[model samples]
Target: MSSSMASSLPPLPRRVGWVGTGVMGLSMATHLLSAGHSLTVFNRTASKAAPLLDKGAKLADSPRAVAEQSEVVFVIVGYPSDVRRVALDPDHGVLPGLRPGSILVDMSTSDPSLAEEIAIAAASVSCQAVDAPVSGGDRGAREGKLSIFAGGDRSTVELLSPLFEKLGVLNYMGGPGSGQRAKLGNQIAIASTMVGLVEGMVFAHRSGLDVTRWIKAIASGAAGSKSLELYGERILRRDMAAGFFVHHFVKDLGICLRECQAMGLALPGLALAQQLYLSLIAHGEGNLGTQALILAIERLNNTRLGDGGESSG
Candidate 1:
């Protein structure tokens, strides 16, 4: 953590509410709990939140219940619809239960416009909202090394700096929906990069080059990328575990393409990547890791990564 990133406002062990305890959310919430904050968590599936409950965090029956007990609430559910359901639904949402002046931080990758809508709704209730989507995947979340892109009131963001520092480096983008827009741009870059990464792997494997050695040799060169470093060995090991799910990546890419189309932009590479990911979903590999993109490329070329045999797909 940088000295400048520290917050002198909120004190330690503040009341923190966390909604969503999925793969990354569980790890993120654990960091705050470990830091001694009074954590209250709510997940749709109570069983998934068992770890936090065992570690001394309180479980809430609903998002509203979590907000009522927390000073600062962080939400990171899947899909924009889930964001709406948890953040804005009048019956059981976080906004309905937020005390005046409390902050709601949504870290989900969602539509930029929806972030703006949430901010507006939060303000109507005399509360604050920040759209702070993160990157670095499950490994980053577990290690507390995520890149948090935050957007909303600068003062509110600064006030939450203490908590943000515990999760990762915070990059204050701008007002309202800027954090989500920044994340969309991130997805655009990642979509194309993933396509290139898998294509290169397929080519290397097909050429009879030792693909693992090839990755090691080129990883330090100009061809190196964060995605390559993160997924290369996993790809070689045929590990399709969900560090980041293919379905989630597809949702992100769909958002990217919609945003691009709204801006009157033409991004063929992004479109192609989205289609490939969609194919994964169609083939029932939606629950797999994003690195399973290699399977699609392999199917296209009639080759597998290690065995050089026909792809089962």
Candidate 2:
């Protein structure tokens, strides 16, 4: 959207509840609080929720408390099992405490089947559910420019557009689990691109070419991608900080691979990328950013990317 158009976005829903305030979630929830929403937030680790509390967001005791206190509860937790525990657990989960007509929007990159299950559970409570997984990583989350892939009832998704607009581009995919499917497709593309970027950079390093210049030379060509643009400089500097964690990317790719297998499909590129990322995890570098894939490449080729100084990646 144009700058002028974005500046004119409607106000977000006033009563907002956010569960999971780690990394991207913290920034996402902060955007809603900044937009003057009466925000209530919950995180398993109390310290992670501290930043939001300092920003005037009320702290909720549990998922149920969060759901009970707000009309729209947004969840961006870790795994599919975590999503289930937070959204579907009978006693303390969000669904059990959600009021009729309330909306449950899970932004976690979880199982498509799990999303469908959550949708069905929400319906029983007269609540609406949307699987709205997002991309753009930490930078995008902090800048409120995440690309959200949503799947649910059309009217329900439309109703939450204003809130989504505050976060980033919102694309309505289809029904129930479609959002997770879209996110899986996104991960597949990302994994492939990451491999390409790392291999290209490794080749540059071996050729004794200036890695930074090499990236700039082809960044706008057919070789360019969001991953390359966002991570190229970091690779050159050997900065492997977790903008998007390696382990999380592994989780996403694992989900995509399982889905592909279940569909009787084979994507060799995605499988290769998954194997490479798993190698990184095996090396005990899973806590590093996805950009740290370069380290794995460097190890395989016996070549490093950055200047021979303080080694990080």
Candidate 3:
């Protein structure tokens, strides 16, 4: 349908077990708590989780503890390995304790296969499962404006709709593994677009054009994006912060490359983007934001930032 006619809403869980208190998870969970859902949270680092507890979210001793106490568990950890450890660690796995009729939503950017395995494991416990990765980053999460891509059974998707609404705009993409496929699709698109942005900033600088004017002028037109309009200046100036970590993007791009290889598709731009990202890592820029790829691009063009990279958090 038309853009304005499309609803923009996020679902709130009835009771949520929010695992992985990282940058995005904290804010998303906060939205649910604020929506009046009872929430129990667990983070490996207790210090990072104390704030939620103080805000009236119940604190759990572990992932399993959180799962046992809540009807729905939402996880958004770092990697596939971490997702495996926290969600299915044999001794105290969330899988063993999650109540029947409960659901487990993995919001981590993980291997698609891992999502399937979690689904099977959840089934064994008579619980439902889905992989529902999010986008729109930390700011969106805090503002309750993320876009959630979910994959699972139709019934489960319907049941979870309200929860997704409270957290972000929701799209029930397809059956199992579809959420991850959509996420991979997004990464592929992002890798290409970000590399192009890097190249454009580098070009503007080497040409001695008023980069602010050049970038803004183009951005005001069809070439604009949330990434460019928001992060363009920071990337152009090489002012890297920790909003969306370069290391995290590195991991995501790597996954996209693997998916490409398995499909026997040639993704030269993504390959190039991966190379550029790796170059940034090799030069110790991993902790910087993914937009820091602009720095590497500038170095390749043998130039410096126009105004030395002014920053915003």
Candidate 4:
């Protein structure tokens, strides 16, 4: 959207409930506070919820409290299971306390079907729910440059536009559950791109080229992407720290693969990439970055990246 067009956006809703305060959530909640919105936040772990509190973000005792306290409740929990629990689990769930006319925005990447189910459940309580899963990483969250794919009513989406802008670029995919579907697409692209990166790096190293420089030179070209550029250095330096965990990527890919199966489609690259990620978990590199796939590539090529020894691939 154009700058002038965005400047005319309706004011953001004043009260926001933010659940899930991990790597991406903290920065996102901080942005809303900076934008002058009142935020009530909750995390299963109190400490993960602390930094926001320090920044003057209010802390809710539970998800129910968050739901009760805000006009909009934003959830960015960890996995599909957690998403279900946060939305539907009785007692601790946000559903019981959420008032009518409130909106619940799920920013977590999870099953689209489940997200739609959440929408239905929220509606029974006279509330609206949308799946607005996000892209961009910890860095993107911190920089307020993430890409959000939202699925909801057009008017309601417009109602939340300012909040979305405060978070990142926005794309309105469709109604109810399209955002999660699009996010599954995002994971497919990311997983396939990483696999291609692994292949290219392995080929370059086997051809006796300076792998690091080659990746740097080629990544800016049409063949490269966020994954390649972001992960290239990690692959070269063999940094395995979790920017996003390998296990999560595997889970994302698993969602995509399931969707593909249900759609009667076939994606060999996605299958291979999924297998590679599962292999990494089996090798006990589940907590490493998605770039840890390079370890798998090196193993297939019978090579190593300096002294990061041990089969924690």
Best by TM-score: 1
Please list the residue runs of candidate 4 whose C-alpha ends up more than 4 Å from where it truly belongs after superposition: 1-11, 307-313
The lDDT for every candidate, in the order shown, is: 0.90, 0.88, 0.80, 0.84
Separately for all candidates shown, the number of backbone clashes (residues 3 or more apart, or on different chains) is 0, 0, 11, 0
For each candidate, what TM-score against the reference?
Answer: 0.94, 0.94, 0.91, 0.92
- Cα-based RMSD of the predictions, in order? 3.8, 5.0, 5.6, 4.6
Residue 65 of candidate 4: its Cα lDDT? Answer: 89
Instruction: Decide which is better by lDDT, 1 or 3.
Output: 1
Q: Which stretches of candidate 3 lie over 4 Å from their true place?
A: 1-13, 236-238, 308-313
lDDT-superior candidate, 1 or 2: 1
lDDT of 4 by residue, 1-313 (tens): 1223322433567889999998789899999989988899999998988888888888888898898888888999889999998888889778877876778899999999998899889877877788999988877899999999999666677778889999999999998889999998988888888888888877777666677667778877898789876777777777778778889888888889889999999999899999999999999999888889988887887886543222222
Task: Record all residue pairs in model 4 with backbone atoms less than 3 Å apart, i.e. clashing.
Answer: none
As a TM-score, model 1 comes out at: 0.94
Report the C-alpha lDDT of model 3 over 137-235, residue by residue, as the tens digit: 777888888888898876677767877888889888887788988988887788888888778766766666667777778887888987786588776
What is the lDDT, from 0 to 100, of the residue 301 in candidate 3?
63
- Compared to the true structure, candidate 4 yields what TM-score? 0.92
Winner by lDDT between candidate 4 and candidate 2:
2
**Candidate 2 segments whose C-alpha is farther than 4 A from its true place:** 1-12, 308-313
TM-score of 2: 0.94
**Alpha carbon deviation, residue 283, candidate 3 (Å):** 1.7
